[model samples]
Target: MAVGSFFGSFDWSAFLNALILGVSIASIWLIAALGLTIIYGTAGVINMAHGEFIMLGAYSSYMLQNYVGLPFFLCVPAAFVIVALVGLILERGLIRYLYKRPLDTLLATFGVSLVLMQGVRLIFGSDPKYLAVPPIFTSNFQLGFVNISAFRVIVLGITIALVVALWALFYRTRFGVQVRAVMQDKEMAASFGINSDRVYMLTFAIGAGLAGIAGSLFGVLNIVLPTMGTGYVVQAFLVVVVGGGTLAGSVIAGGATGELQSVFAYFTNDTFARFMLYVLIVVFLRIRPQGLFAPSAKRR
Candidate 1:
């Protein structure tokens, strides 16, 4: 009788709502982690400044939309281009020198992150900016019994498109083969006439561009500020770490972690839920430190 009452009293409607929202949450995390995964997986460099790259994207969109009078839709790609260019310059000027020095690279990127943050803060003056989306995106629509934001749906669609595009880029193209070869063995790739330096430069730029896209989308979802990237980056790092720094791993980990967090929050408060999720993650890492999809052993 006790067990029956406990089961019967469970809120099925809320559970369904949580599940729906969980997918949205997963999309956000996956998009945020995408660039980090690409950078770390390909270059073997942990970019501590990735959050700054995201911040730049949001600011890039803001400037193009507000000053240049560009449409919001156009601003997205423009942000990508602008940030990718910045990333390219950064790789050429600084990061290219620290390739195999993990500790030095980590510290150097951390310094770069601080510089970017302070520079943006000085220019933007800590004011929270906003990205104005279309009226349609600002509206709420029903998804079965749940009320869903049209913007969230759009974000989810965008995330899926990015994933598919990345998959095709990495799996179907000649450039993809070169990238994989370099990742597997830089010297072997060089022996095959592939320019490892060029590959690293391009991949880093693309990864940064992906971060820019995430920032552009995220700006509309939350207030745009220099510090905005910090929160998303934490989640991004969590996704990448748990995912084992692979594209597919990020997708899987993002979904699982988002769903688990949502379900936990449904039962408890958000604070407690996060606490529980962190505890679980610690336990999981303890059991499998290599993560869900560790890189191939071929890579030194």
Candidate 2:
């Protein structure tokens, strides 16, 4: 009788809501991981400063909106451009030099991350900043048994659009061929007249730009702080690792992790859910270290 009563009172609506929310969570993580996947997959650079790039994007949007009164939509693209330029400069000045030494690149990017965090704290005074979006996105709407945030729906839509755009960019463009060529065999690509340096620079810049867009959306989802990027970066890394350095892998890993976390949290608390997720990831990695989608033989 007790078990039957418990089952009878189960909230199917809440389950539906959690499922929808899982999609939103997956969208956020996928957006964050996409850039990392591209940079790592193509260049074999594990970017330790990716979180800082995300922070810079949020701050970029805040600065534009506060100082220049740019609309939210405009600020999104502006942040992308700003961060992409930063990425380009970094790739040219520092990252380009450290490519052959993976350890040096890792340490250098870690230093860059510290510098960016401190710089933001100095400039912004360690205060939390808020991004204002349009009123239409501020409200929630009910769809059947689940209530969903309009902003989350917008974010999901944007993520889907970006994914499609990235796919097209990677598959249907001449630049894509150049990037893939460089990824497959840099020496061979250079011999064939493909400038590997130029390709790496552009790829890093695009990766950073995608991080910027994620940051822009994230700013709308939560308060922006110098340390905000740290939280998201961990999840992004997990996605990239579990997906195994591929674009399609990132999408699948993000969705799977998000849904698992959501479902776990629905039954347990958030802290426990996270703990469980980490444990599961650890066990999975122990068995299949190559991840869900392995990179090509050349990438290995």
Candidate 3:
């Protein structure tokens, strides 16, 4: 089909709806990628077990809501605390020792990923789990030509809140300064009495916590499974890479990719849309490998 003809036949209302859907999609990707961006951007650690952390978050929320009868809304933060603790333990026990050795860290985290996947499988079995939200969040709302889920709107609000909170945390806080100093020059940061080790530990924990929060939201969006993290992590990595491992980069990359994918999928099939998305990413990276927004020279 010719491009002009295709556009001529396109339903503008559907296109507008797709764009609105794109916002929700972007929020999802941004939430998932935010944690990874922090860890990799500041700490320079490519966390292979990130997906597992997300998985664990979903599981945490599930157990809390199912077994303890916790409210679904309250389970979100609970999941974060639980996963953050797990991340703390992993960083202190294993990740800390391997930071200087990037390749070893990668392999070790990959092993951790496997362990987490299997552990969840062993405990929860391979069956998919459902996360039930309140009735208010279960309905869809229509705005003009676009119809969207209430829960998705809530997720978008949460994502925006998180982005703002992170910005404040990274820029307006003393701890944030310490983290940025360590990222720019560890030796200099140390000379300035900044404990790089503690900074890294806190950063990793926060990252894991963010992933957990994302998992909780995702659980409601789709079925909760041990392997669900794998899918989100791929998109997270793409966002991080394309955004050049910056927080702003993640926001831009996630929004751009999510909208592009939705638009393409609207025009064609989902499978082909993904294929084209990947091809576009590849070509874009080839042309400007630095990403949409590159990190600072000192950080790099």
Question: Which candidate number maximizes TM-score?
Answer: 3
Instruction: Give a tens-digit lDDT track for model 1, residues 5-124.
Output: 978879888799999889998999899999989888899888888899999999999999999989899998898999899889989999999997967877898899899999999988
Better of 1 and 3 by lDDT: 3
Locate the minimum summed-lDDT window of 10 residues in model 2: 291-300
Ranking according to TM-score, highest score first: 3, 2, 1
Best-fitting candidate, scored by lDDT: 3
| TM-score of candidate 3 relative to the true fold | 0.97
Residue-level lDDT for 37 in candidate 3 = 95
lDDT of 2 at 184: 84
Please give, for residues 226-260, the per-residue lDDT of candidate 3 as tens digits: 89888887889899999998899999999999999
Angstrom error at residue 56, model 1 = 1.0
Where does candidate 3 clash, by residue pair?
A: none
Model 2 ranges with Cα > 4 A deviation: 1-9
For candidate 3, what is the lDDT?
Answer: 0.92
Candidate 2, residue 200: the lDDT equals: 99
Show where candidate 1 strays beyond 4 Å.
Answer: 1-9
